[model samples]
Target: MHGGILGCASAAEAAGLWVMPFAGVHVWLTPTGHERAHDDCACVVHWSEALAFRRNRAVMTVPLALEQMAYCLGKEAFFVALESALHQHKISAEEISSLRALLPHGFDELFRLATVSAESGLESIMRYRLSLHGITVRGQISIPTVGRVDFVIDGWLIVEADGKGNHEGPEQRHRDHLRDAHAAALGYDTLRFDYALIMYDWPSVEAAILGRLRARAGRVVAG
Candidate 1:
């Protein structure tokens, strides 16, 4: 019998084991549990019990399951679980569509998840799209002259996703302007888009980006 180190008090109680309240949950162990440790608090479970709990799918929360999978099976396995959750709930399509509207360059599903805010559920959608495109999109980047940009495309194009929080103060706006100037001086193209452009007028933003990419391609060819 194998058991994980962590289990809820209720679970331990149901198993007919003596449980000691620790934190918010019960910790279960052998009668001599107190004899082993000197200071640090840790839960001990029988190996058989741990294995049983691990095999019991109903015992784990989604986040817990994800963490377990990441620890045991690695990141690729975690991604599989992520995609399964998205599809199982029938949210993947909606998320992908939303991101497509915002980013025409195409993104992977992970981006959808990354950007889905808990309040609005957009972070997941953003994470998913970014995963699909394999864009390696990060939330923020700081360059010496550019200061910081919201996102970097291929380490060259600085993309700013201008939400209200980002543009609230005059100081922020001035700082952004300086960052853009610095990025330009460093031969990096900067693209800034407000929330409206990202959420409502994405086509225009896409076109601008596409045009710039095309121009850059032509320059490479000519040079």
Candidate 2:
């Protein structure tokens, strides 16, 4: 009973009074010369709908033998899209493995790093390399009258990567300074590199230590 100007256009096309939007489109027509758009498009029909209707009709009529492959697949429907998203975000290997372990059913072939323990000296070397240039470098250098120094490269460098429950309190600091002074007297340098430096800012820590080492080296070379 209700028909607007656009509705009349649709109705006229549907009722064979005029051509439908496409060759094979069968739009609904009422006997009273009215056309009814699909309920989904009742409120508004975009101009592009005509083009889409024609294209859809063309697609539906084509034989499997005649249709060519489509050029672009939707990203949401592609596995590579997911992989690209992961890589773009720099998802870590450990995180991927953890996710796979937690969600046992879904994903496959998670990334993982090789499992191996780093040696003590190797770890030290790694730190040393990270230190800035002109820092000291002393390997297995001792505290003279106390304990064996792990490393003392720069003249005042006293690097110690301590584990839990070691080197705590004023007494320890005093003793460390005393040892440091003794080493200084012996023309030694002291600078400490700790777990924090190793874990975070490792590069900057290495740069700093290297700087001190380079400066010490320069002094020795200059002398």
Clashes of each: 47, 43
Model 1 residue runs over 4 Å out of place are 1-139, 219-223
Q: Write the per-residue lDDT of candidate 1 for residues 147-209, one digit (tens) a residue.
A: 755666666777666754757788988887887888889988988877666556755866665
Query: What is the RMSD, in Å, between candidate 2 and the native fold over all Cα?
Result: 24.4
TM-score of 1: 0.42
User: Per-prediction TM-score, please?
Assistant: 0.42, 0.36
Instruction: Give candidate 2's whole-model lDDT.
Output: 0.38
lDDT of 2 by residue, 12-71 (tens): 233222111222222322233344455445333212122113344311111110010011
- lDDT for 4 in candidate 1 is 32
Which runs in model 2 stand beyond 4 Å of their true positions?
1-138, 154-158, 219-223
Q: Name the candidate that leads on lDDT.
A: 1
Question: Candidate 2 has what TM-score?
Answer: 0.36
In order, what is each prediction's RMSD in angstroms?
Answer: 16.1, 24.4
